[model samples]
Target: MPKVSVKVKWGKEMYPDVEVNTDDEPVVFKAQIFALTGVQPERQKVVCKGVTLRDDSWANFKLSNNALVLVMGSKEEDVPAAPVEQTRFVEDMNESELATALDLPEGLINLGNTCYMNATVQCLKTVPELKNALLGYDPSSGGGTAGGLTSALSETMRALESGGAGACAAAAARLLNALHAAAPRLAERGAGGQLAQQDASECWTEIVRALRMRLTVAPEPNSKSLIEQYFGGTLDVELVCSEADEPPTRSNETFLQLSCFISQDVKYLQSGLRSKMAEQITKMSETLGRDAVYTKTSKISRLPAYLTVQFVRFYYKEKESINAKILKDVKFPLELDVYELCSPELQERLTPMRNKFKELEDASVEKSLNAKNKSHGDSKKENKKRSIVPYWFENDVGSNNSGYYRLQAVLTHRGRSSSSGHYVAWVARGDAWLRCDDDTVSPVTEEEVLKLSGGGDWHCAYLLLYGPKILEVPEEEEEPMVTDVTEGPAGNPPTALA
Candidate 1:
């Protein structure tokens, strides 16, 4: 036996740092070298056979002090060439490589990113059969383990169909649950399936349509109950003016002036109505008093023997006469039927003004009817034609107030057109005398004027009083009408209240 010395290098860059001792017996030497260097004993064989002494022949060897000592022999043969060193390295390991080596389903391999891979794994866990299939044993395949779990599911469904009932229920339930869980994952990947994508698109389309409809038919919140029966809900509202070239002006002055207008409507001057109206006026005065001026004027016209009551509410930050801060000047033409219930003397005195008022109201109604009739024939054509004279007041009042009153007659125009069977109303509030004969003249009917005098339109009037006094309207009680039991076949009586 010959002894040999061995050295081992480890890691990427070989470093000459490890040495091992071999015994005289090559087998024992190899084993000892392997034990010391932790290299395979078989790999150390080449070193065992190549040792020699100074005689240039095979050396006899023996172990001494954990090292090999060689003894020269009489015969020597060609020394074996030093064995070439070889190293083995395993290929780098990763998810894809591991999945491939284990023969996993290609679907899992196709997951583009780690997030999707994790999501899919989570979804599959809920399906016991699918999980088992991935783990190499598929219950769906009739007690045999198969790699084609998807195919096994399909075959199971087919068998259930052939078996005539209930065989696939549990599997179907599991698949549905899996699909539901996986849907959100697919959406994040922007890979929503065809059916889901279509449903989402349709829902968005309906929402857009609803918004457009609301914009078109704007409705107020207070009007909700009245319109909801027909329109179903409140609508989005926006205010638009006709003049495009002239931008509307708004200021704190305008706000105060408008507040004056609102004050006049809230305050009623008639003696009989004063107490109830005074309370409202007082409330409104508190809100507008800081920036507004209030004045009242009464004129007696002999021809009509009627009282011309004028209330002017002016609002401005600076001190000035009411006429100096005029934002709008409108003269409302009104007709009163004093003859309907009045003394002969009063009627005689009112004859001239009453006649003039009636003529103006009639002429205004006729003109409006003509325009409406003309519009009916060709509304599109009529819309293109500009009016030569604008009837309604066309001034932007310089105030932020919601209401005001000026020493101007406010007219209410109303009439029924034969062509379009609906009552129309037009209110004009200005300072000039109404000229009825003019084609542009706008007049208000008697009923409309009364409505305005009684504190705005019907709705506003109802709201003003409905708040606290609604409980005051006495509920009517009806007396019951009874029918005799003899007349009703001796069992019961009939009552009208029923």
Candidate 2:
């Protein structure tokens, strides 16, 4: 099915150029309508050609181009609403009111060349656990630069969550001040006495370090902090000697984020990550007591709830005296499966949950297909036979049950070097995305998000955030569908509406 532009008539208001993707469930279309009309999906009654839209299927209607959709439902608060003439369109609303009415997250104001910090802040805020931990952090108990940084960050996050433009700037200004105080190099001034552009990845690392030092909300009993529990992953490392006949040395190392090293052969994020897992290094062997070549192998021993992947695109160029960037297009997936990248022990632990996820996904597809053919009563009966997939671990809130993750946020840069580029944050909001570009936040699509994967002078993905992929089994009982095509002019054409 193709996407079609339809005119939506809600009361006397006629909204033109409304896009409907017939391939997706009607609920997704309802979400788009809700974004425009402020009517909840459950409350909406979209009718076309005498057929009321169903959440499960669109088999009953053959909607063509310029088809008219009559949306008949008032917002819950506006059930006893007055005339439609009194209603103001989104275009007519003021800036603050528009942001409020659209339910957009506040964007950070760039204080001079601080887009890097702003972009990093927006990306990190996509993790709810981290935000909650920051909000609950006590700066008084914490000490040193980390404490002040954490305090400023908590305040900045609070303002952003507050959904007010004014507060966002004030809080962001304080965060910038805190950053300058903590790291003077970040606030380095140029010869012209202007604040220089900083590296967004470096800023992200420093912020994560500060949060790990503070924000003491342990997800599990013996865990360090919320940052450690949610963002931390373990790598099982093995070093094999090439010359000596010594046993392989094994060790476990923890990491908050993974570094993806981009080489000529690395054309995808997975390949870059895999390349870093095994490499040759010169080290002294205990058996030989001399320098020897060793093959270092590493595999993921533990998976985190939220995984951060930094693209190592910048390299120090001594000739240019700058951090040059690799503008290679490294493709990444929306849904990433890392079962093969994990150690045998961890893979064994993840198999059950991964199997359950596959089962649930297949069942969901089957249910969606069956709903188009089955009667409403049959659909309701099928709900009773549904099974639940139990959590993989005792404390699974901030942990990955299966070795799968979905892309949540992407931090991108748009220049030749990290120190002289514009940074932006593209964060997932339900099925849509929000592009946070220094106090200018706007809606974007997943396609647009994927296009950020570097090739040219466009915004290239520098940092990627992946969250645990959790699948939910949907209930069969859907909202009541209302049928009324006779009220609209487009539906009541020369031929009778089927």
Reference-based lDDT, residue 480, model 1: 23
Q: What is the TM-score of each predicted model, taking all chains together?
A: 0.13, 0.73
Mind giving the per-residue lDDT tens digits that candidate 1 earns over 442-476? 23233433354322122111001000000011112
lDDT of 2 by residue, 1-498 (tens): 479999999998899998777865565576566656767555778999899886546878677789999998887677676664356778976565456548877787655578999999999888766776666666575467878888889888888877366556556766876777678789787776456899998899888887776655433334466677678889999999999888999999999999899988999899989898999999998788889999999999888878999999999999999999999999999998888889999899898778878887787798798777988897677667332332224344456768889999999999998889799999987667888998778776688899998999999999999987764433342112211211211211111100
- For each candidate, what is the lDDT? 0.24, 0.77
Which stretches of model 1 miss by more than 4 angstroms? 1-267, 271-343, 372-498
TM-score for predicted model 2 compared with the true structure: 0.73
Question: Cα miss at 340, model 2 (Å)?
Answer: 0.7
Q: List all candidate RMSDs to the true structure.
A: 42.1, 20.7
Clash number for model 2?
0
